[model samples]
Target chain A: MTAAVETAQTTTIHGDRVSLLRVLGPAHVWALGVGIVLVGEFTGWNFAADKGGALAALIVCWIVGLLYTSVAMIDSEVTSTVAAAGGQYAQAKHIVGPLMAFNVALFLVFAYTMLEVSDAILLGDTIVAKAGVEGLTHNSFIAATIVVLAWLNYRGVLMTLNVNFVITAIAYVSIVVLFFSVSPWTQGAVLKLNELVTPGNALPYGWIGVIAAFQFGIWYYLGIEGTTQAAEEVRSPARSLPYGTMAGMITLLIAAAMTWYVCASLMPWEYLGITYYPLWDAGKLTGSPLLENLLFIATLLAALASANGCINDAARAWFSLGRDRYLPSWFSAVHPRYRTPYRSILFLLPIALAFAFIADLNQAITFSILSGVLQYTFMSINIMMFRKKWPLGSIRRGYTHPFHPLPAIVLFCLCVVTFFAIFLGFGSQLIAMVAFYFLISLWFHFYRYRFVRRGDQFTMPWPKPQGY
Target chain B: MWMALSYACWGISIVLALWMLYDWFKVDTTYSEDMLTSSREGELEAVSEKHRI
Candidate 1:
């Protein structure tokens, strides 16, 4: 993607953080806490619900989550290193040059935006489908949620999280209730170990299906960095971030796994895969419309709450970029009262809204998966570089992945493979990412012509501290 | 009940995080020098020198 390479933009020490109300500490962040990520109930259930792959899938989730933990841990550390307002893009831009950083910033926003759109589209579809309602435009619902999110965020960051809080609470209640209904009754449905471990224990569909099938599970862990993105605004970065992502992941693991198990035990795999509303399907198997609606609401809340992470996190990324003059000054403009970037809001909202009018659930999912891989790769690299350059002192200096280099190496390689997996999974459509990169290039071209050459050199300078 | 309680615990935590930010971190685009310390004018040049943006 193209970034408006700042030639030598004037420097400003006017970095402002959204009030603490916008920052979260470990006190609030939970592991795998997000329900919307588990929304791909169909895909997750596909493996664990049937095909006798429950045990295998569970092991796979543990493995993948474990692998990702290092990256998540490292991210918490490096991101916390500078309490300054600059986020990943800032860190990358400073480490690399402005141009490279700009490209990364563009890529990060593009990926995050696509992910949000995908979640919105799916949740909308899940809701309508579960209702047995026809003519439901899934993408529209997704798009609409983005609009609402944009609207709420524009009012300020607190509004966005407030919305998330309400939405998440409702969704959590519904999910827990669904669990209650499905758990005790559905327990014991997992395949017998002996049935599989012996000779012809249904040789899995080779490693390809196994890896590709595991992609959805990987996504459940992706947004754990939500706290990292919001680090600067946080009061006590050292403690909040290190634990927040860990908490988020832990929350997701148990919640998602249990949800999968509950659904898997209650119904058949094909049933889970076929319905857009996997949770609702679980309820229906129990023959409860009330329960179905309950799940439907949960799905919606999960998706919306997940979007909260996007609205605050993604915009902040762009806001960070704007602050660096990597993109444009417009994005850096914060509302007088709300303290949030009003500029990026204008940009993000319209595109999300347009996407609502077009595109489908699958497209959003594809975009998210592809972009997510890109962000993960860059973030892992950034952490490794930071650790190599700056020796750690206090946890406040930066949060390091427990094992350090090993996890970083593994995550970096895994991401590279995931990138390849995207092309294989999406085929011709994979070109969309390439196209996105080029489009960003074009944007950079225009941005440079108008800004950089016009004496708006945005090259970030050497590190400067406050206390002298 | 444990699951429900856990979910509730998670919910309260998020709300608390939101509260921590006073909802203002939502507006910060990057961790800039201006953010860490309130407006201490002469520090801009020093802060800039100390931290690489």
Candidate 2:
């Protein structure tokens, strides 16, 4: 193969060719994964309580946690082997085809962008609530937060990771504090399993309520997989990716359990069901203004941490696609001194700001979950495909999943169920997701027939040349 | 029926969480070392081939 083809196949940053610096370590990876989903511990999952009561919501969270665990296991193996910045997108390209790859990239970008916008809005509202500033508009705060996060991201990957680490640590410690301070176990309150099932009970809505609550329950573990996007930038991804993802998953599971248990037990399920911010309400249940204030700060920190990680993940996804010529080449440009994807971060900043101002948080979250479920489905399918294409002993294996394709298959099935549940729960958002996919498909087909058929330079980088 | 399902889900999640923790601590790091070594060798070989060309 010619040098040009080799370069094109191996590396994606062309024209003003630049590469990403491997600055992230295992601890950073853990923080990235945990930070992206830590906000779930503060809010969002309470909607599940509304749907299915405390016990039912806890059950749904448990089920979703298992689904994410299976996904993490499979993804660990795939990321260890491929170790690309594009992450699931790159894996899809190699295992499936370019069409699936493009679709996955679009889904990732949509999911992370929506998450970023939603978290920014949540952060602004949290700050206003903490300050007791009535009638103060949060839109300005949202815009300011977006700009600051974008600037921090552009400064360098290390700075962004360091900030995320501190914010994530605070967010996690707050959850532990909340659990110990208010939970029935620590509060000397009577444990009542029987009351959980009494007529007009905690689960007054019934089994259907459990199904209705699945989407909200999913909040606890939604964006953890985005950590793998840093695979190329992490030191020894083969080890760190698995270690980081698994550790983060375990932490999230514990946090989810503690949050659900504490919030559910401290207050009546009926009351917890209606509150938008359950953690804040849990603090209120303590009848202590100081604890409420601390929980308020924790809520803001959680939102900021989640938003920071979303920016990091979204920018890398955009950078990878742009570098690979899936998107415009300008997005691939790395800052000369900082070695960061400044262009892509700037490009996404305005969009996030606009969405934060105008979009409804509930709808944005539903859409984000929709996109995330689709991405997980694709990742699971790609894992199976990779196993078939390159069997266990065929490639220089890093960390092989213990059960081969079982975990992948299970994850795929769970994702399909979750997709249908989300569609049923949020019909309008499902329609929007379908329309978005349709538009993406049209562009992909047009690009393939128009540019690829004509042998243009802008083509999908797949069926990678030998020895790449 | 909902009660049974909730209990089952909780059981499964606890088991899964424990298994993940075990796997996280027990999984070997030697594989990553081998991978890094082999990747460096591959890069060197590629450079040598480029020079010959």
Candidate 3:
């Protein structure tokens, strides 16, 4: 009823924990969100063209873009309000229960790690293809990249932020160059939208193809919510969280549109679909080897930047779960000097490498999107629960969703659609996702449930701060 | 029918993006300076306490 009574939830963790240094500002947070996702603009989204052709892929892109917009809006409201290092996991703990929190943590880690693994593999494949390196194994390259990223992450948060900002800037600038160089406007070609619908072309696979395209289309915005994992390191979580997320989403949306339009217009959908690096291929269409080489470097940088952010997010989620005793307490250990989550980052490196070796790019993308949608569904539900549990009048809030329940409800329905897309399009991967959920639930019942000492609690500090 | 649906999806997406942009600038960014700095120390202390546990 009262603000004090509403904020009375237990804010303590029982096990050993280490604080993350708050060195990141709003710009760094934006870089983390966009950098984790910018690679999709360069490579992955073209896969949708194979399934649905240009027109259908464009349609799917619009739908998926809207879905992520809803996700970004709702996540901005919830993350700013909760403001914890755990990100979605912490939000789940406060609004749902520990069981759901455990599940969300696992899903978040799975999604980010899978993205990282995929990027490592893709970067290796790109090097081999672009550099004409003979007999170089993708496995070796992926292993080496993961090790390098892990070391850089272990150094310190500031170094990681600085490196991410530089790589993210290069990736985005490359996209802008691609847009100008290959765009229909620059080439003096009108977009023949009708040409995409020629008999056996547009929806070659029909509505099923459109559904299939959703998975790849989602890659454009998959990692934006990851910015919230930086809550602990952000100077002003309440203000920075929303600003970074929404701004990142807007930038990605524009980038996605430019990418899809330019690539689809410049090249045949069939050729674009098969290429490992679509932006590079699009640059090739301009008959400039120089632009192609530049795009090659950009694509590699995008993958590296994305892998960097993925490691940051997945490590934080692991740290949160470990701190709460969901996993072993050893994972909660922070570097003595760097103050980084060294243990968790090291723990994940081998698993990520192994996943990279076995999983193909398409499988990795679908798996990541599927796991992300699962986590987001719970996040949407948690938003509604938070509002009902602590109404606007009952709590000191910095930012709240303007439409409140509408955005959450929309996000839930969109997530359901995405689930069906992944399920029907990639049936085998869906089974694996189910198995993962089962195993996580088993662990929760056998071990984690016992260690859950706290109830539904919102222990974040409230009231009084402005302009941070 | 598919063409019609595609157009509709594009239209709705455009509207949603515009609405999100408006909400970001109008509602979320309109917080007072008091709300931003009110519990700065308390919030940081709470975060530290959570970690120290």
Candidate 4:
């Protein structure tokens, strides 16, 4: 109280402050993170099985689970203190320099936007498959999804995430329903245990196979860290951010395990790896129209929930960047009526629509995953720098992750292995993305930095760094 | 039949997008930059009892 009051007296009142609505609780944060990721269980994760085998995919699932647990801890610590909309991007700015923040903001934008695009495409495809109609263009469904979800986001954060919670809850229930329908408890029931030990099924591609599976392993929990993006909007960031994030991580780990078990036992690795909707396929294997219908509806809801979450996160990152004058200051404006980042939300709609229209689902997902991997890699460094600059007791943290540097080191090493896995599969695309970011960094340094408010960028009122 | 559904979806999307664009322009024309960019975070922070270092 004394320090804050003193700082307030010294600091200038820089006009009125335009901010996001801080109405969210831990539940909204959980919805935001889990909603963006639950869709992955339906579609993209099976690609890991395709790369390696069912056993390899399961191993990668747990490995990536460990990777994301570290992420949840590190992010919860940093975001609880930072309390900003851009999540890791905001953390980078306060802890590292502005250049790093700019790149991190881009990573958030692209990662979520690409994921949004993939979700929209899957939504459209699910509808198409359900209808089984000839000459049904997916463009309309994709466009409608982007438009509708962007509208939800532009309206308000509370409504957007509240809707996400409902749909995401239903989608999760669908997974549980599928798990129960198989009767895994009964001896010699629906599950074929041979799927695990069959020749070439356990480790189809050997060591390289497990490494390659790492690329798709992320699908099990891609956007759980996104819970922090709601930091600026949450009612109690310190408590809510960590609680929501850790809960979401736990939920995802359980969901991933159950999804893997049910799907792997129901189908052979050869078929499960290549299938688009492993859960839905498993539903079909039950020979029950009711289960199949339920799974299909569940997939649709998950896609919608994920797309909605992606739009919300990407727009917040863009809005934070705009607020800092990294881009046009005009984009920072909040809707007076709704208090939402309306302009930023509108700005990203076309970008997501463009990708949804042109890019294949696998390509869009690969790009999203790579973008996320890059962000996590940055996070490992960001947290270490944060501690060195302002060790413990220098500032108040909402929650402190245990085992300090261990999580950071583990996150870094896992990120390196994941990158190697991606390189084995997407070497050319990885190179292209690197080149693209390099070009953009040059542009930001030479051109955009002039527009940024350097002195005003540091919004937190904590004391200066040790050396500074 | 599905084509009709798709076309209807496209039509709804276009209409919704146009409305948003109109609202965007309306909001821009209606409000000043100062008012639009004004935030409540600083005010709340000042009055709050939580003592952040």
Query: What is the clash count of model 1?
Result: 61
Off by over 4 Å in 3: A1-18, A186-200, A455-458, A461-468, B1-53
What are the per-residue Cα lDDT tens digits for candidate 2 across A216-302?
A: 888989899988988867867878999999999999999998888777766677777767678887777777787787888888888
DockQ of each: 0.06, 0.02, 0.02, 0.43
For candidate 4, give the lDDT of residue A73: 98
Residues forming the 10-long window of minimal summed lDDT in candidate 3 chain A: A6-15
Local distance difference test, each candidate: 0.56, 0.74, 0.75, 0.88
Candidate 2 clash pair list: none
Tens digit of per-residue lDDT, candidate 3, span A372-453: 9888888788887777776675565556777777778878887877777777778888888889798979878887678744
Q: Per-residue alpha-carbon lDDT of model 1 for A129-173, expressed as tens digits?
A: 544544444544554567556667766554565556566666656
Estimate candidate 1's alpha-carbon lDDT, on a 0 to 1 scale.
0.56
Number of the top-ranking candidate, with DockQ as the measure: 4
TM-score ranking, high to low: 4, 3, 2, 1
Which candidate number has the best TM-score?
4
Number of the candidate with higher TM-score, 3 or 4 = 4
Provide the lDDT at A178 for model 2.
72
Interface RMSD of each: 13.9, 18.5, 18.8, 6.7
Winner by lDDT = 4
lDDT of 4 at A348: 95
